[model samples]
Target: MDDDENLPRKTNDPLAALVKQDLDPLSVDELDERISALKSEINRCEAKKSFAVSHRASAENLFKK
Candidate 1:
């Protein structure tokens, strides 16, 4: 087998791939999709933060009682 074949493959970076390629530019729709995906991820993180805050509040109230 060739040394090239023995080398591990790099994981695909969609953003970097888009940035690297000059021949085919990213479309508006593709940008929107990326934005939507980021928004969803943000919402998920926010939900987790809110849950942690509420849980902390509940624990504090219990301690005070």
Candidate 2:
């Protein structure tokens, strides 16, 4: 039996599938596009995190007053 057969199959998670994607078949342009999209996602996540942190601090200050 193949060793890979013992491994778990792909999950329903898009991020997990993306991480396991075969990049060798992709063209340079496709790779560039992927990188750009990933950067945009990173920026979005960072903005959300910043907002959450500031919002929590504001809430804490309000209760302390």
Candidate 3:
């Protein structure tokens, strides 16, 4: 038996779980609300990605000197 088998399974990420969820159960208004929330999360992720890219560029420039 593998040691990894004894460990508990890792849960799916929030985004992954969201994608897998049953949308049929939600009302039209609830679906709209979820879409808005997902959009904000996407914006937040994009900002973080931009910051990371900028930071990496800065680090590279510092090391090149």
RMSD of 1: 10.7
Task: Give candidate 1 misplaced runs (Cα > 4 Å).
Answer: 1-24
Lowest summed lDDT across 10 adjacent residues in model 2 is found at 7-16
Question: What is the per-residue lDDT of model 1 for residues 1-65, given as tens digits with 9 covering 90 to 100?
Answer: 78876765565956457446563465989778877987898899999999999999999999998
What's model 2's overall lDDT?
Answer: 0.93
lDDT of 3 by residue, 1-65 (tens): 99977876558656557767999999999999999998999999999999999999999999999
lDDT of every model, 2 decimals: 0.79, 0.93, 0.88
- Stretches of candidate 3 off by over 4 Å are 1-10
TM-score-based ranking: 2, 3, 1
Q: Write the residue-wise lDDT of candidate 2 on 1-65 in tens digits.
A: 89977877667868779888999999999999999999999999999999999999999999999
Q: By lDDT, highest first, what's the ranking?
A: 2, 3, 1
- The regions of model 2 sitting more than 4 angstroms off are 1-10
Q: After superposition, how far is residue 47 of candidate 1 from its true place, in Å?
A: 0.7
